[model samples]
Target: MKNRIQKLTAIKNAKKVDAFLITSLASLKYLSGYFFYFEHGLSPFQLLPAALVVGVEQQASLVLADNETQQLAFIDPSISVKTYESYVYQKPIDHTTQFLLQLGEAFKQAGIKSGRLGVELNALPASLAFFLTAQYPAIELVDISAEIAHLRIIKDEDEIASIRRAANLSDIGQAAVLRLAKTGMSELELFNLVRREIEESVGTRVPLMADFVSGTATATGGGLPTSKIINDGDLILTDFTPCLNGYWGDSCSTIVMGTPTMEQRSVFNLVKEALEIGIHSIQPGVQAREVDFAMRQHLQAKGNFGHHGGHGVGVIYHEEPRITPYNTMALQPGMVIALEPAVYSADYGIRLEHLVAVTNDGCEVLTKFNHCFQQGI
Candidate 1:
């Protein structure tokens, strides 16, 4: 934790900022160790109350609603914590107003009254941006979103452990799909059953994203679960991404309900080979685009696959170090990425994905699940 603050402090001189006001949920969780409830559909107003203030001269601090004081336990003891009241019926001022007022105190206490402040221009709320400029007319706010994102691209030990746990949960979901999916089951039923199995493993509700499609639907690339029925000889493509412990896990597999035809087996083998080729290309100092090119070149003769080869996975499901034809970012140790190779047609489609962590010499495949159809065995 101290090292992260020092690294941010090192950037202050170059960016010409005295302190940083971290508003993005990912940044806050990464720097302060406080995992904010960042579920989707929450209004921006609800997200305005959390911030992490780190100054070059003074101590680091966190600002949040008083109701969230318990989060202090998770934060470093060296950093100060400030809070405002929340969930009150008869308050002298509204919640946003109180939050802004308390935030001003946090900034002032951090010795950020003047000079420049590094802010996440993309993630900061318009209201908060206005408040900062209006309150401190002398202070200049610089956009440091890109720098922060670059720092998060590399997973520290703590982050790697969290992702490993999340990946295990993903494996659990895939197992459920393989063990429970049967002929005549609706897509939605199988999706629900898989979700239930994941949540049961974690002992709590988990935020999940998925592509649950079967038969002809898989040919469309991917989609949400529907009432489509699974039948004998139909292929089921299951791509599940479950967020647990503030980290995300991604896994995908395609299985046939009954015995597969020669054509189905051929396409599945081609895609599986493409995925293996992509994984083998992952090594330290390798360019991300090279990985994409290798996989795309292997499947070009088939002419049925399109989409990125893979992408970095951490706090965000799909982030930097993108494995596309255009990206030139080099793969490094501690980088966790998901690579998916697919073949789509009007009749059926097959996609196989694996989550891997770049190692000093090679890569470690985090996903452990069988890649076979039920009846093929």
Candidate 2:
């Protein structure tokens, strides 16, 4: 978390900004080192609008609603916490006005009165951005979105540990479904059951879902679970991503309802091979696209491939250094990635995904689930 603040300061120094604001919830949580969502069930997209502000010579500050003042004080008593007029009592327009007014004051308190300031323009609301410029004509607001992305790409040790914990929780959920999901159960039932199991397994509640699919629908990246029932000779694909302590863990596996047809087995084999090929290409300094091309070539030659070979997974489910034909960023140690090489067809699809970390000479798989058709436990 200190590195997060230090990185933003480094960016501020490089850009010659006296102060910077962090609007993205992910960035705030990363820097604040507090799990804001653990006790609150709200999604980040609809969170209690909050921001973290830092100045060159001042302590970091938190801007949020007044009602959350006590909680934030209890969590971070030392840092400055500024709050707007109560949003609960004010009209929507007034709320926005007061919020912006308070935000402007926070900027001033951070010593941005007549200096360049940085904000995550892409993530900050357009109207709010306009209000900021209008109210603080003395401060130059620059978009530091790229710098924020760069800062988040390479995870620190704490982040890596949280991601691993999230992954373990995800595996617990998927394993429950695989072991107990029977032919007669509906898709939604399996999802609900596994979700409960995941919730019970974690020390803190984490968001969980199963891309539960069977029969023909498993051929694609399935959506939410439905009423469809598992049947004989059908394959079930379950991909679960559980968010824990602000970090997400991803895991996917294909389970058999009965015996797989020879042709179906062939498709699974090829997909497994593609995943292996993609993983084999991962190492410090390897080009991202090179790994993607190596795996995609196998599926492309055989036909019916969709989706990127892999993507970075950390505070956000999908991040940079994407393993795609268009990205050329070199892999670096400390990056945790999910390599998912899938094959989609008209009838159904088979794919495999596992989380891994880029190491000095190679990549280490973070998840250990039963991907074996005959011996998976």
Candidate 3:
């Protein structure tokens, strides 16, 4: 937590920001180590579930609803917690007025009268922006959401541990799905099997999402599981998501319902090779685009392949430092990345993904799962 604070301070200082108003929930947690579920009526946006105001001088305060304040205390005890009453409750205090008063008090206490105030415009609502500008007309509001996100791109030891556990659970769910996959199994059945296995294995209600599609549907790559049944020679693509400890581990594997055709095997081999190339490119000081290029070049050398290669995985499934041709962010040690290489065609599609930890010399694969395309019982 101390290191997180220091990293934020460094970002603030580098941007010459006096204070940063963080609205993104992940950013809030990264800074204050607090977690709160977003209430729809209060804050519907995932990006700005709650607001966190942190000053360059080491002052930090969190603005949340009354119901969430106590929950946040369990995770972060140092942050000054201020809560506003719920809008549905009819009491002496009203929700809007309570939030306004709390924000005013927090601003005043932080001595943020007139200076360069940074806010995550991408995450913040326009109405909130107008209200803040109206309240503090003298302060200069600046958008520094990218700076805060870049700071969180690198994972710490604890974060890596949490993601590793998530990956392990995801592998378990994938194995369950594999066992249920057969020539006549419905996509929905496979989905429920994996979901039930994850819940029973963890002994808790875990957030699980998976896409089990067959034949032509497989080309779509990702979608909610349906009742579509598998057929012999049909390709099955399953992308697994098992959320644990407020983080997510995402992995996708392509399998054949029965025996694979020669063409299908060729496509799967190419995708697997592309994934390997991308994984080999993970190391400190390597440009993010270099990995994307490596994978794309592999596919282009064979033929045109569909979809972007992969992306960063953390609190949200798709975070920063996206693996695409457009992004030039350099790979750094301590960054957790998901390498997914996929190919789509009219008849079938195949994708193989693995969660990797970027290290100083090379990369470490965090997810443990067999990539075989054999049919399951």
Total backbone collisions for each predicted model: 0, 3, 0
Q: So what's the TM-score on candidate 3?
A: 0.89
Encode model 2's per-residue lDDT on 245-339: one tens digit a residue.
67889888777777777877887888898888888889898889999999888888567476788889987888988988899898999899998
In angstroms, how far off is 69's CA in candidate 3?
A: 4.3
Off by over 4 Å in 3: 1-3, 36-48, 87-93
In angstroms, how far off is 210's CA in candidate 3?
A: 3.4
List the candidate 1 regions with Cα displacement exceeding 4 Å: 1-3, 43-49, 69-73
Candidate 1: tens digits of C-alpha lDDT, residues 138-243: 8889999988888889888778778888888889988888889988899999999999999999898898889999999889878999998888888899898888
Q: How far is candidate 3 from the true structure (C-alpha RMSD, Å)?
A: 2.8
Best by TM-score: 1
lDDT score, residue 261, model 3? 86
Worst 10 residues of 2 by lDDT: 39-48
**lDDT of each model, Cα atoms only?**
0.83, 0.76, 0.76
Show model 2 residue runs off by greater than 4 Å.
1-3, 34-48, 67-78, 85-94, 374-377
